[model samples]
Target chain A: MLISSAQGAVRAADTLITANWLDYLLIAIYFAFVLGIGFMARRQVSDSIDFFLSGRSLPAWVTGLAFISANLGAVEIMGMSATGAQMGLPTVHYFWVGAIPAMLFLGVVMMPFYYGSKVRSVPEFMLRRFGPGAHLVNSLSFALAQLLIAGVNLYLLASIVHALLGWPMWTALIVAAVIVLSYITLGGLSAAIYNEVLQFFVIVASLLPLTLIGLHRVGGYGGLKDKITAAAANNDKITPAKDQLESWPGLPLSGFDSPLLSVIGIVFGLGFVLSFGYWTTNFVEVQRAMASNSISAARKTPIIGAFPKMFVPFIVILPGMVAAVLVNEIVQLKASGGEAAIPGGASGDVKYNDALLLLMRDVLPNGLLGLAIAGLLAAFMAGMAANISAFNTVFSYDLWQTYVQKDKPDHYYLGIGRLATFAATVVAIFTATIAGKFGNIMDYLQTLFGFFNAPLFATFILGMFWKRMTATAGWMGLVAGTLSAIAVWSAGEFGKAFELSGQGLAFVAASTAFVVDIVVSVVVSLMTAPKPEGSLKGLVYSETPKEDLIDPHEASLPFFQRTVPLALIALAMVLVLNVIF
Target chain B: MSHTPERYDAEDARDDVREDVADAGTDTGSGRHTAGAFDIRNIIGALLSIYGLILTLASFVGDQSLDKTGGVRANLWTGLALLAAGLAFMAWAKAKPIVVPDHIPHDDDRPAGH
Candidate 1:
């Protein structure tokens, strides 16, 4: 599997797990298991409720794991690990600051609105609170985003398999989609969640070995730091002062790397506004919580998820650190005798996305390699299945039922949901196959995330806490905030083109959009007529009693109850990890 | 001039009563009401069993070569055990397909929905 170019520097074509009998065997069994879950769950899906929300019958444990698993996307794993390698340990802040606290906020505060509202989807909530304009805009944006996300995910999965297995792009895309489609169509959301939990375990079990072995070989965590630092420091192509290998910035921004991006940007832009926006408002993630059988269970969902979510960086990020050393060594060796380095391949520079694979190639033997690869494949499929489930639910409830055909039979909507799933899968697969034509779509979509999410969060904050927020205000605020975000982004791009210091434009876009949304919403709410107190009964905080929002049973429990305690534990672990690194 | 306002509480109450009555009368065939929409055991078991079976099958038919499995039968052994475990789950589900009694406790006490 060695790929030697004309320059004679050998690059490993097979990323890892030299593809033997047991590897294929493990993978095949996993596929069969995924299908079995789907088929077995089919009969239980008697109505659209079953298809979408598992009839809201799932327990906290089931919902929690699935909740985390959905966000623990396979596509993002490579990106996270890559960030780990490039930006150093500050990347973990993306989880600790950006995710953990936000998840808790959603669980403790926001779930009351989502689960208590009895709304089938996020857009439905918007329709109730704001109006049709906000509802339509959000539903359309999310629906389109899911499809593009699914398509890109499929393409990403296909490309990886093509590179590793030498299978055609279509083979990988079709096989993965078919496996995902089989169970989703058969069992619906329950099957999807069950499989997601299964994928989470499979991926964790497979990759933990990579981290353990990598650390063992490098002596320990301290050893790894020393080795990687030395290698990075000596590499002639890029002069890396020892500080470059550091987790905390020793200069200026002592808590985080100032040169990379500020702690303010990370904490405020990402942690507060953007994180809350995505975690709370986006139904894709909240769908897991919304499936819990009781309000109590629903509230526990995200907190339960946070425990495992905090620990993920150990497996994903550590491998990147290990690769940093291996990469430095490879670069030094390639350049030692004036020999040609293969640029982005094995002998030249570390491919951040391929950090995990590069680690496998460097150390693991046959059996473990195969398992790790299988785990990765499972994770990718899990993410795809999650998106598909969310997409189908949102499409059917928000778009199809409300607009197209009203008050149809239960089975009629169920049928439509299944059809939507199939259609979405096909569209994604096709998009993956033709992904090369519109390769830059991924970058555009990333920028568009802030535009859609940041402004939306501002509206939600006003709508939830402020009783004076009129429906008209909701619509206007959303429109104005979104436009401001777009304008900010355009200005950033324009500045970048003109060679201006467009540093941290992403953060700038988000913070500015959020501020504008808040100001506009407040002013508009004050100017416009507010909804009468009686009409706003269950929706607004002023009208809804304290009991409905906070469960009596949960409230009566000790401070050491599962909700706050789990969050504290997660925060503790993140702090420990940050300090040790 | 005077104005009047109306709320949907009474109508919602009526819908609740009708929904309850319909649920009670849902035993369409002959005798009993089974699991309501969600069959947790069957669903979980099915996933577990399938997962188990695949592992077992892979163990038997999987390839062996250098830079691969090193002829380890952990995959096969693990799969067979999982398959058996899965079947056991299915058997448990069949034995106890949750009856879901007609009058669920505290049913009238909670809010109907958002």
Candidate 2:
């Protein structure tokens, strides 16, 4: 075998992740401690509120960390690493442009309605503002979406744990589900939040070492970029021109090797529409903000989250960049030996999804390796817990309680909430089983995210700010918006089924839905009778007074005490990274 | 729209425990802050302590490896680190006990059980 002159040669046999007693001890301790937390949290389950919102007593810091950690799923760790390796610095767009601005908007603009309006779920806001029809549509879709997400998390966890533990895939999944569900059922949202905080810390601890070690081995950040450029030059297939490697965030929609979606897609679709829709309206993120006890705490949740979020591309995407370079070096070494000068040359095929796994096997030692693997395992569980916890609440409150039974005792709902956790877990297990049949699970999940969140932001914006918007108009716009997204996504799936180079026009459809929802909402609103501002207190901009929305505590503190300063800092960091890279 | 306390959960307030923390900010810490709200720090410490003790003990008995683990007994190191964290959490919780004001005002109409 040709030894490539990069950092060091990685033999095939060395990739095996063998766990000694120390490693097993760490893993065992992790599981036991997790189960213990579940048991401990059990006593605190006083009512349905405690079961769902952790009694809404979490301070800003807890909710804030949980908010982002809830999202740092298997997808973000694995898929985003693949993105970083494939796209280079531009994948940072996902954190910077796609998430941060929208997160800020959610904190500053939407918290009044979400937190102050006394809504239990996102759909509750729909019910209060737009009435039953819209509530039914939003809540049902959200519930289903969450279940599918839980399954995706399950599949990712099972697959990775299967690799690390060398256990049957089913065994790993069942153990994870049992562990996560136990705590969730016992402690409820509080359990999920508490665990999410743990997962957040663990993920950071696990990934930080990998980045530092990899950077040290490959030389520092300066050398890292230079190595990538040199590799790109040698492997001409990465891009047509060396100019592509000149700066960070190369050409948009340049495809494969190029980082970033097209400028139009990033600005119009992601930055303007999709980001706003998902961050502002998605119940998953909004739930964390809503759980804070005080108004200021709730509003500050996402803002605090945004700070850590800015650094995530470094944690997630940088490793991918390193992996991509390593893959190229291996491929280049093989090609020099007169093999097929083709796409699948030298190393057969390097699975980008396995980039972090490769990095782990290459760099991390067995004990820390096991801990790192555990951290990864925790990430998936945190994601799974977030989904199942959210799903159970929405399912119980929105569907089961609303449509099936009504006005039972508080204890009755609390029991149902616990029961709902099991139900959600079962559905997720089944969903993960089915998801195994899919060709690419990531694409399937992305389609679901885009299908729901893309158009919903328009309805949310109008509903929150526009008093003249009728309840009928709100529901109608939402329905029309949802249908348009579906139509586009379905068409793409249809095209792909026939082997036509036509997989869904994600950005095109999302951007179009943003416009379509706005037009449909305005036209429908004018046609229907307007709801008066007086009847919309706490739910609409005009009636939800600015004073009620303002953080009373913020005034007593300095400007830096507020979230805006942190948001500004986050933005400044993004700008600096963009320039340097 | 006539207000009957908004019936917070339309399904059956009995099953009303879903969604993110947003519309669910009913915990003003007004109602009984005690029944096991050990600042969440307590649990973190407990967890760290449990893991630390187990791993620390295993470090002596477990198969030693320099080739596999970059010459570091990571379990032993990480375990000790976690132990300290757990103990610190216990100390912090003991040092300061927080009490919620009796009348925490908010516009969130507290549903039954909230």
The TM-score leader among the candidates is 2
Chain A vs. native, model 1, TM-score: 0.89
Question: Which regions of candidate 2 fall more than 4 Å away from where they truly are?
Answer: A1-16, A239-261, A327-350, A437-442, A496-504, B1-37, B45-114
DockQ in order? 0.06, 0.13
Give the DockQ (C-alpha) for candidate 1. Answer: 0.06
At residue A362, give the lDDT of candidate 1: 60
| lDDT of candidate 1 at residue A102, scale 0 to 100 | 85
Estimate, for each residue in B1-76, the C-alpha lDDT of model 2 and write its tens digit.
Answer: 1111211221222122121222233433433232123446666666667766765676677464544344556557
| Candidate 1 chain A, run of 10 with poorest lDDT | A248-257
Model 2: how far residue B39 lies from native, Å: 2.9
Chain A TM-score compared with the true chain A, each model in order: 0.89, 0.89
Cand. 1 TM to true fold: 0.80
Q: Per-candidate TM vs. native? A: 0.80, 0.83
lDDT tens digits by residue: candidate 1, A405-480: 8777778888889999999999889766554344233234445567788888888877888888988888777778
Model 1 residue A376 lDDT score: 78
